[model samples]
Target: MLRRTLLCTGAAAITAVFTGSLWHGAAEVRPGPGRYGPLKVPDTNGLALPDGFTSRLIARTGHKVGGLTWHAAPDGGACFPDGEGWIYVSNCEVPLLGGASAVRFGKDGSIRDAYRILSGANLNCAGGATPWRTWLSCEEIARGRIFECDPYGERSARPRLAMGRFKHEAAACDPDREVVYLTEDEPDGCFYRFRPGDWGDLTEGTLEVMCGAGERVIWKPVPSPAALPRPTRHQVKEARHFDGGEGCYYADGVCYFTTKGDNRVWAYDAASATLGVAYDADSPLTGVDNITGAPTGDLYVAEDGGNMEINLIAPDRSVSPFLRLDGHGRSEITGPAFSPDGKRLYFSSQRGRSGKPTDGHTFEVTGPFRNLVPPQRA
Candidate 1:
C-alpha cells in the first residue's frame, strides 16, 4: 500500500572494465530519488509491476507454498523466521541430483507448509541468508560447493568443502566482517573470499582470489583448493575475471555482484579495496541473474534470460524495469531474496509457463520497500 513512484533522476556515469582487460575505473554512487521510482506499468496479471507494485502467487510448480509439495526447478531463495511464520528456502535446479526446498509462509503470504530442505546436491543454484539464520545452498557444477540450510526444518544439510569448489553461483555475508563472498558460474568466473577460521565457523576457510593490483585489490591465494586435474578457474592466475558469475551480495562493506557473461553489475570496495563496475554493458540491463540488497541501498538484478525483467539497480548506477515477464516464455528469474521484514520480495519464475520440467513459480512482492539502512561509509 505504498506505490506512488515518480521521482527518478540519479545513477549513470559508469566506465567499469577491470577484467575487461586492465584499467578503467569510476565507482561512483548517486542513487537519488530511488526507492522504486518512475517506473510502473506492466504486471498484466503476474509480474509486470510498478503501479504501486503487487504480486502474490507464492509457490507453484506443483502448488503448496507450504504443507510440502512445491518442488521442481525453482532456483535460489532464502527467508527464515518461525513463530509467526516465514521460511522460504528454495533452490532446486535439478539434474542428476539437485536439492534444496522449503516453504511455510503465513504472516499473510499464506501457505503453511511444503518441505525438502536439501537433497542429494548438484545443480541447486543461488543461495545466501545467514547472519546465523542459515540457508546457503549453491552447487552449480564443475564440482560446485556450499550447503548450510536449517530454516526451521532442523539441521543436517552438510557440505561445506571449506567453501571452495568452483561453479557455485551465489553467496553473501559480511556480517560485520566474518567475510564470505562467492560467485562463479564459469565462462572463467572468479571472485571469492572465505576466511572463516572461526567466528560463526563454516567448517573452515582461506579461499582467496580477487587480485587486481593496479587501482588496488588483493586477496589472491587459491592454487588449487581442490581442482584436482586443475580447474578452479585454472587455479586462479592472480584473479579478477568474471563475466559469468551470476549473483552475489555482501552488504555494508559493499560487495554487490552479478555477471551473466557480461550483463555486469559489480562493486567490491571493502573500504576502497577497490573493484567497481556498478552496472555496465551499456546499461539497459540484461540477463544478470540473482542479486538482492534492497531496503533502499538499491539492487535487484535477476533476469538470467534477457527479457524476463526484474532489473532494479540504483544507488546511482541507475537502472529500472523492477518487474516484467510476459507469460513466462523463455523462463528465467531465479532467487532475488528479501524479507527479514524488508517488506517481502522473494522471487522465482524459473521455468514456468508450460515450459514444463515440473513448471516453476514462487512469488510475493508486497509493496513500499525502502527501509534500507546501513550505508554510512565515507
Candidate 2:
C-alpha cells in the first residue's frame, strides 16, 4: 500500500498567551539534562523538557473546566482541529468505569467547554484518530474492543465489533488506504489490521492478523472477531507475535508499533508486506510504548516504564532522549500527540508519583519541534 506522502508547509499564527502559560512546581525533585543532551531546567513543572520547551497544565484531577470535573488516570490522547480551535480527546484508564473525555481549546490556548464523550468501558487505554475525524478509544481487557467517538461529544460511542475483541492497546489509521492498524496488550498478542469495505467507513471490515517477518508476510483473517477461542497468535501458525504491544502510528506507508514486554519498536510496511525493527529492544532506552512520527521522518517513542523518558528515533535509527520524568515515579509517558498546527505536544503522566488514581495529569509542551510544519486547514 504505497501511498502519497503529505509534505506539510507554512506556519500557524501563534498567540502570545499560548507561549506564556506555565504550571507551578509539582514536586521537590529537580530534573537534570537528560541522557541524550542538556535540556533547560523546568522553571515550574516537574517535566524534564528540552532546552527550548515549556509546559502548561491542561487539566488535573478534581479540576473543572466546563461544568464537567476532570477524570482520574488520564492515559492516551489525540488533538483534533476545530473551527479556529482544537479538541483534545483524552482516555480515562479507570477499572470498570473507564471512558473518554474531550476538552476544547481556543485558538488563544484558552480552555473552553469540556465533556464526557464515551462511557461504561474497562481500561480505556490508548487510541488513534481517523481520517474521518473520529477518535478510536481502545479498551485493554480480554474480550474488550474499540469504540469510535466524535470529539464533538455528539456522535454515539458505538463499538465496531468487527474490529475484533481482544485486549486492545492502541490503533492507528492510514488515511491513504483507509485501513486501521491495531496493537494488543497481551505478551503474545497479535498485530491486527481492519480493512473497511468503504473507505473511512468502519461499520463493516475484515479482521486479520499479520504473520511472518521481513518483506515476506501473510494476512490471516481471524475466524471469529467477536469471541476468539484462542489468542490470535495461537490461532494462526507462523504468525509473528508482539510481546505486550502498546501503541501504534501509521505514516509513510508503514505502521510503527511498540512492545512493552520486549521493549521494542516494530515497523510493518504495508507496501511490501514486510516487518522490521525500527528500534531494537537492546537499546538502553527500553519499555517503549506509544509512537508518533515527526514530519521530518523521525519517530518519537514514549516510555511505558523503564526510563520514564521520551526517546527520539532518527530516520537512521539512532536514539536520543527528547524528555524525561523524575519525580513521577513509575508513571509512564503516554499519548505523545501533536496539535494540528504541530506547535503543541500533548502527553500525560499515567500514574504521576502521588500513586493515587487522582494524580495523573495531562500537560501540553510548546516548542520548536522538528515536525512543527503547520498542517493545511481541512
**Per-candidate alpha-carbon RMSD to the true structure:** 16.8, 10.3
Question: Per-residue alpha-carbon lDDT of model 2 for 1-378, expressed as tens digits?
Answer: 111111111121111101101111111111223333665564466877776788887888777866778888888889899898898989999889999999898998888899999988889999999978999999998888899998998778988888988998899997766689999988788899999988777889898898775445788888878765775557778766778989898876778888887666766667656565555544446688888876766677888777777877665334677877778866878888888888888888887878677888888888777656744536
How does model 2 fare in lDDT?
Answer: 0.76
Model 2 TM-score is 0.87
Q: Give per-residue CA lDDT, model 1, range 66-149, as digits (tens).
A: 566777878888777776767778888888568888777778767777778788888888978877888888888886888888
lDDT of 1 at 315: 57
In terms of TM-score, the best-performing candidate is 2
List the candidate 1 regions with Cα displacement exceeding 4 Å.
Answer: 1-15, 18-49, 52-54, 57-66, 69-114, 119-145, 148-158, 162-206, 211-219, 222-265, 268-274, 277-311, 314-316, 319-362, 365-378
- Candidate 1 — worst ten consecutive residues by lDDT sum? 1-10
Off by over 4 Å in 2: 1-37, 213-215, 281-284, 374-378
Clashing pairs in 2: 1-271
- By TM-score, how accurate is candidate 1? 0.35
lDDT of each: 0.73, 0.76
